[model samples]
Every structure is written in C-alpha cells, then in structure tokens.
Target: MNPRRQVTEHLLRTYKSALIGFAGVFVVGVVIADIVAARVADPAPGIWMYVAIAFRYWVGIIAVIFISNNLRQFVAVGVTRRDFMAGATAVGVLASVAFAVFVPLGHGIEYAIHGGSGFSAATGFREFAATLVSCLASFVAGSAACAGIYRFGAWGGLALVIPALLPAAAATIFLTTDSDGQIAADHLSFPLALVVCLVATAAVAVLSHWELKDVTIRRSALG
Candidate 1:
C-alpha cells in the first residue's frame, strides 16, 4: 500500500469507534435539546449551533489524543513522518467536511419539525459554506495544537495554544456573532470572515507541517 494511504486508513480505523460514539452522543443531545426547546417559551438556539460547539471541542480532544498516543506507533511501523502528517491532514479535512454537511442537515430536519419557530438553523447556501469553512478551521486548529505539543513539550504547547485557537475563534465569531461579538438577528456577510478563517486554517496547516516534518518521535513512557 502507498504509505500515505496506509497511514490514512490506519487513522480512520483507529478512530472510527470513537468518532461514531461521539456522533451518537451528539445526535442524542440535539434530540433532547429540541424536545426541551419545544416546551419552552423562549426562542430555542439552533441545533447547528450546538453541533458547532461540540464538533470543535471533539476535534480538539481527538487531535490531542492522536498526537500524544499514536504518532510514534506509525513511525515505528515504517511510516514516514511526511506520510503520517499527510494522512492526518486528510483525516481532519474529511471529518470537517462530514460535520459541515451533517450539521446543516440536522438543522433542516429540526426546522421542518418545529416549523422554523424556535431554532436558528442555517439552511442557505452561504450559511452552509460558512459552516463548512468553520468546521475545517476548528479541525485544523486542533491538529496544529497537537503537533505543537508533540514537537515542543508542555511549555511550548502552552505557548502554541493561542495560535491554534485563532482559527476556531474566528470561525465561532463568524458563525455566531457580528464582527464586534454581539449576537445579530442574521449572520454577518461571509467575505471578510471567510477570508480570515481560511487564512487561519492555512496558518495552522503550515505550523503543524513545520512541527511534524523531520521531527523525532518521543519515546513512550511504557517503553
């Protein structure tokens, strides 16, 4: 098998159960939230909103786990660092795309059920595009943070968190609020926000690649 393809398949296989578990939990949470919102007087927050938050956090957690625990194994098994990084990047991008598509679909279902009364779902093309970029940004940020930690240890990891957070923050601001952080009745225009998010994602990818390429794998404590 091609090294990059092998690494990608390894990642997908290793993470499959965890990702499925997370998705199940997310769906249950959204359903419960929808039920509660139906009985409430206030306008319910959107399902997609909850999805965005959960997805961002989940990606971060998974990235940290992967980098902390699995990279060395891949290297030991003859995977080149470049191949591993490429595969990991592919995993992140694919996961981001899946979330981007599914979240809006979930929102659409909720909207139909609730008659568009309570939740603020993103059902439009522009909104979907924004959501897609935001998901990608969050995944990249998480991957970058993990790479930083793997490359630089605790102190360096702490230092790198801010840069890793930029893309996720930009995505959140773009998706949920005006440029000034105030909640708006409608989503802000996508041009500037998208540009910022794309830039942040690019920055994260560059940083992660720089950290991972040609780096030595740490010895596992159990060794």
Candidate 2:
C-alpha cells in the first residue's frame, strides 16, 4: 500500500469508532440542551452555535495524538519520516475539511430540527470558511507542539509551546465566528484575516515537518 494512503487510512480507521460516538453524543447532547434551554431561557440561544467551538479543539487533539503516538509505530514498520509526514498531512487536510463541513451542517441540522429561521447562505459560507481554516490551523499547531515534545524533553518542549500555539491563536483571533454564525475580524478585513490564518497554518505545518523529519523514535513497542 502507498505510504500516504496507509497513514491516512490507518488514522481514519483508528478514529472511526470514536468519531461515530462523538457524532452520536453531539447530536443527542445538543438536542437535549436546546430543549432545556428553550424551557428555561427566554429567546433561547442556538445550542449548536456555542457547541461547535469544540470541533477545532477536537481536530487539534487528533493531530497531537497522531504525532505523539503513531509516528514511531509507522516509522518502525518501514515508512520513511518524510512519508509519514506526508501521510499525516493528508490525514490532517481531510479531517480539517470534514469537520469544516460537519460543523456548519450540524448547525443547520440542529436549527432545522428545532424552530428557527435558518442562517443565510452567506452566513453558512462564512462559517464553513472560518471552520476550515481554523481546523487546519489547529491540526498543524497540535502536530507542531507534539513534535517539539517528541524531539525534545519536557523542559525543552516548553520552549516551543508559544510558537506552536501561534497558528491556532491566529485563526481563533482573526477568523472568529460571531453570534450570527458569520466570520468576523475586529480590525482586519475578511480577506486579510483569511490570509493570516492560511499563512499561520502553512508556517506551523512547515515547522512540524522540520521538527518531525529526523525525530528519534522514543519507543519500540507497537502495543
């Protein structure tokens, strides 16, 4: 099997069950929260609106685990470090795009199930774009952070914490979502914010690759 496909498929398979459970829990939890909110709060807020914030962090966690745990295993099995990075990048991109769509789609589904005027196509587009960039940034940042720790010890890794956070921080600050589900920037124009987010993601991705390419595999047990 191709290394890229092998990594992609392995990561996807590893998360398949967890992803389904998360979806199930998210759907059920949001519905219950909406019901409870509708009864208690006057003009209940959209449950999915706030709940969707977890999606980016979730992507980040996946990236962290991918770098921290799977890198050694894949390399031991004969995958080159460059190939592992390539495969992991492919997985990150797919996951970023998946949750980008899932976030907005889930929000729409939540609104449709309850009673509310749906968000506009423009609002949805903003949400989609913001989520895509944010998730991508999160993924790269997570990998970079973990790669630092993997390459260096605990104290050494601390030095990289702030730099690793830059991508996700830039995304969160620049392409943030508003209450109305639109992406908003406090000072920067929409185009500029998008550019900043993409640049940050790309930079961190490069940093992650640099840190990981020749990283020592700390453990030998595949278990």
Candidate 3:
C-alpha cells in the first residue's frame, strides 16, 4: 500500500514495454520507407538526409507518445519540471549523437548519387536555435499529451490533442498549396500548437492530481 513503491514498479513495467514497442515500430517503418523512396522517385540532392530526418522526426513523436501514456504515475517532487528538463537534455544529447553518426552512413547511397540532404543545414547559432525551438515545441506538445493522457486518461488526452488541432487542421487544408513538403516545417503555427498542447497538459495534470489527493495509498489501505 506504499504509493511510492506501487507507482515506481508501475512506471518501470509500463515504460519498458512502451520503449520496446516503439523501437520495433521505428525500425520497421524506416527501413520500408527508405526502400520505397529509393525505388519510386529519383529525388533531388539531400534526399538521403531527408530520409534520415524523417525517421528521426517520426521516432521522436513515437517516443513522446509512449512517454505521454506512462509518465503520470511517477510525477512526484523528484520528477518535477527541473528534473524533467535535465533528463530530457541527456536523452536529447544521446539522440543527436546517434543521428549524426547514422545519418551520413545510412544516406550514403543517396548522397553519392544525388549530392546532399536538401533539408535545412544548420551551421551556426541560428541553426542551433531553430533545432532547439523545434525540440521545445515537441516537448511542450508531448508534455501536454503526457499529462492529459497519463494523469487523467487516454480519452482525456485524445480530447486535448484533437480539439487543439482543429483550427490548425482547418487552416492547413485552406492555406497550404505548395505540395506537402512545407507542411512538415509549419513553423508559423507552431507557437499556437505549443500553447494549446501545454495548456491541455497542465490542466489535466492539476485536475487529476487534485482528484486523487484524498485517495492516496494510506487512505485506500485503511478502507
């Protein structure tokens, strides 16, 4: 009936399975996507880099999805915002290194044939800043989803990601005319998305915490 003991074990089992499933999906999805893209279109320069970027981007989302579904059980003082940030930094650093190594090698054929990775090549602070911002955007969105889904429930989290996306989804259908490429880099609307996502996350976190306050383990055990 110890809350800490129960929650810690719960988090470990849930996250372990989620992480493994995510990895399997990522590997299968990327390998197939790469082979198909190679066969279909003789893409422009940087195509391989594009492939690498696509995989990494999608995997990041998938990671967030898993974390979102399972983090709420462990959000005590030790897992506060500061602690989350520190952990995120360590994860980000490791991921970035892996990307740097794998990308050049994996996309070697595409580069050898076409030339470069057509994606935005970050050279200076501006590039670094942009990358950081995108990561922040994902963090906010993921945090919100995590709080809503994990703390509250899946249905509650879906309520948030869906409703928040409505306006943007409508505008995307209305404004985007230049193929589907720029749609992925939709920076102009990211701030709005971040706000929506974070608000939803925080709301769910606060409410769920309040809802369960009186039902803590000691109270439950005595009952």
Model number with the top lDDT: 2
**Please, what is the TM-score per model?**
0.84, 0.93, 0.41
**What total of clashing residue pairs does each candidate reach?**
0, 0, 3
Whichever of 1 and 2 has more TM-score, that candidate is 2
Off by over 4 Å in 2: 220-223
Candidate 2 residues 95-213, lDDT tens each? 88887888788777766766543576777777888888989999999988888888886777779878998989998888778555766567788778888989988888888888888
**Weakest lDDT window of 10 consecutive positions for candidate 2:** 214-223
Q: What does the lDDT read for residue 127 in candidate 1?
A: 45
Local distance difference test values of all predictions, in order: 0.70, 0.81, 0.40
Tens-digit per-residue lDDT, 1-223, candidate 3: 5444444444445445664565466556656665666677666323333333343343345335434432332444344433343344345344434444444444444444444343233222222322333333333344444444544455755776554333223333322212111334455464464454345434543443343343222211112
How do the candidates rank by TM-score, highest first?
A: 2, 1, 3
lDDT of 1 at 39: 76
Give stretches of model 3 more than 4 Å off.
1-46, 62-85, 93-132, 162-223
Comparing candidate 1 with candidate 3, which one achieves the higher TM-score? 1
